[model samples]
Target: MTDSLHDIPAVVNREGGALDGPNSLVDARVPAPIAPSGFDLLIDVRAVSVNPVDVKIRASANGNGTDRILGWDASGVVLAAGGDTHLFRPGDEVYYAGSLDRSGSYASQQLVDERIVGRKPRTLSHAEAAALPLTGITAWESLFDKLQLTGGSNGALLVIGAAGGVGSILIQLVKALTDVTVIATASRAESRAWVEQLGADIVLDHTNPDLARQILEVAPGGVDYAFTSQSRGRMALFTQVVRPFGQIVAIDDGRDLDFSALKDKSISWHWELMFTRPRYGWNLEAQHELLNSIADMVDAGRIRSTLTRVLSPLDATRLREAHAIIETGRAIGKVVVAAER
Candidate 1:
């Protein structure tokens, strides 16, 4: 099986193409990625996922860039390994959120660091696995590392933007590992139901002005901790709902939040970036270890994959359609494009 990794890279965008950003459509061609050292894993990408970063970078590109591939999530087979690679050789079916600083998994063959990749969960198809990596990392880090929610904190958790990519996965992880009551905010009927089904104990509408009131209506008292996967527009409201000294972790960098509001409550704020470990080249193996743990959870049925829609044959047209849907801010789960069939 390891010998099968020798296959030549098939997907190429020789002219350095572009896609519509974050909620837009982009169609362009670029060059195939090159395998580098220390972290040499060439994935024969079978399926890929669109994240918020993909949308943002595409929207910002002015056609003057050269090496700007912006996909982060993928499920694929390893085509080649660097000389020092040991975690996985070749021909392994894997899923990963590749590095932020490098070209990403949008192409058919992607070069990735071995530390960041994990064997695809046994139960899911390529498309399903593609959706897990980025959101999974963000949710895992937000709940456990940043918020310190795992150390037997027998309390309630409020999750903002409960229907988005990271929130969807966060709800499930909290349900699986901890006894915390999961409270999530969703504005739409479908989104409300989606979070509840995903494992949120209670759902609130974020668009409503009476968020604090509504939360108190459900929990009666303030929440023990909060996780905000949505935008930063509601920092004030979040401060209101969190108990004194309660922890608040947000994955998105919110806008000009005055920490003064939180001072009264002694609330702690944490920022979670999934790319931190890989982006700065620190504790890289921890990524491999963390993802492998997720694999076990997924296989045990403790956590489920979050893939919602899957398109066929990675191309500019289908990629554009997926990007367009994501930009609308209505996509409930992750969308993926398969490079083959």
Candidate 2:
């Protein structure tokens, strides 16, 4: 660490419990990261996007009297690169949904592995690029990796909670890369419009008690695949609307889900968590490639950023506000916090 790297500004959760409004996030300074080694890149964080995982972790954190930084989706410039780092060098602009085991992007600087980082899209500002990584990766993994969708495959896909971050990008990827027809569900009129704008062929009101019936009416034989952001208590809906032997990919923790319901239809259920790659060190480089593909699609105008709101100055108060917006569960797309100019 250089002399100028002694202190770095950050927003952290001092006490790990339920959110107490603004007090839940506190402004602080942490020591500069140790010199980058191996595949690490020391980054000057330019912007960060808030995700539901950040809200969940903040609400259930246990810092043990230590400050815990909570952020994952970030876009930044590389300040320094480790000896083994080949994909990026100092001054390279990059974006990534960083690993959960490390201190996160809620700071002036962060240390991330290069294997999970991608060149930031040239057409987007730092804030816009920041919004893509986490949700984009989740959506990509759910479609291509879990649901096994391909460009040649032609079928209907049901997207539950289609107005939020993951669904916003998921809908776009499906339109851009596959022949699948999208039947997205949203309760609010604005959400329906948002999904349609993202390329949903049909939009259904998820709040409707007869949602499964409505889905079946649209895609009569049942959807070929289902992607649900909120899967708790919705297994029965998936069973009712998904075709026999179809697959369902979910991001939520639906521990109470009854797998037996799907037995009759032989419906396969898959859980997609973007963190799984870095968390267990499984095929880590795949995220790097995935983000690069997303960036290419974005630059090619095949996909667009999901950033819907931005808060300025990257302070504790702004982070708290972002958290509050996510907690409401009504965020139309992604909310970002940018560094002060």
Candidate 3:
């Protein structure tokens, strides 16, 4: 580890508890972050976006004896690189979904692996760029990597929960690269319109049984691929709407699900966990490649940032408020906490 230049303030949880009370707030004496293994880059964090994982983990995650810092997606500048790092150097502006194994980016200074970081798109602000990494990676891997979707797929792509973080970005990705018509499910009027604005070819109400009916009216046989980013109870809906040999990819971790119901149609099931690469230390460089590729796409106008809101000051109060908004299940797009102004 290199010598510490300065200690930066960060949001921290000393006991790893709930977000409602004294447990959720800013801290002044939070230690500067460290990345002691595999690879490391000191990042001066500028902006960060909140996801359900942040709220869930903060409520339930345990820290190793010290307080646990919380954040995943960040847009920032590199300050230093560790010995094994070659992909980036000091002063490079980058964005990434950081590793779940260590301290996160809710700090002014953080250490992350170069392999999971990429240059920020020229067109986006730091907060906007910060919103893309986790959701973007999840959506991209779900469609192209997990579902194996391409331009030649024989049917439409059905996206469940089309207005949330991952779904919002996923809709845009499918619309941009694939020839497949996009069918998105959003129960609210605003969310429905949001997905359409993102280029969804059709929108259905996940709350209505008529959703399947509506989907069938447009796509008679069934969809070729289904990406579920929201409630896993919708897995049954996926079973009903996907054609034989169709693929189902879910990022939601619903429990006690019965896969036996899907046996007859031979529908394939896949779980998309964006942290898999960083978690198990497997092919860590792929995240860098993916983020860099996304930067190219964003710069080219093939995709846009999904950031819908920004909370300033990057402190615990704002972080908790952002988390509460998302937990309401009504946020139309990503919500970011910008660095101190």
Best by TM-score: 2
Encode model 1's per-residue lDDT on 262-298: one tens digit a residue: 8988999888888999889888887787788898999
lDDT of each: 0.80, 0.92, 0.84
| Model 2 spans with C-alpha error above 4 angstroms | 1-5, 21-23
- TM-scores, each model vs. reference: 0.90, 0.97, 0.94
Candidate 3 error regions (>4 Å):
1-6, 34-38, 61-65
Which candidate, 1 or 3, would have the higher TM-score against the true structure? 3
**Which lDDT value does model 2 have at 175?**
94
Which candidate has the top score in lDDT?
2
- Candidate 2, residues 1-341, lDDT tens digits: the string is 22354888889887756677544788888888889999999999999999999998887857476778889999999999999999999999999999999999999999999999999999999999999999999999999999888999889999999999999999999999989999999999899899999999999998899998899998899999999988888888988999999999999987878899999999999999999999999999999999999999999999999999989999988988898899999999999999953
What C-alpha lDDT, on a 0 to 100 scale, does residue 6 get in candidate 2?
Answer: 87
lDDT of 1: 0.80
The list of candidate 1 runs beyond 4 A from truth reads 1-31, 62-64
Report the CA-based lDDT of candidate 2 relative to the real structure: 0.92
RMSD to true structure for each model, in Å: 4.2, 1.9, 2.6
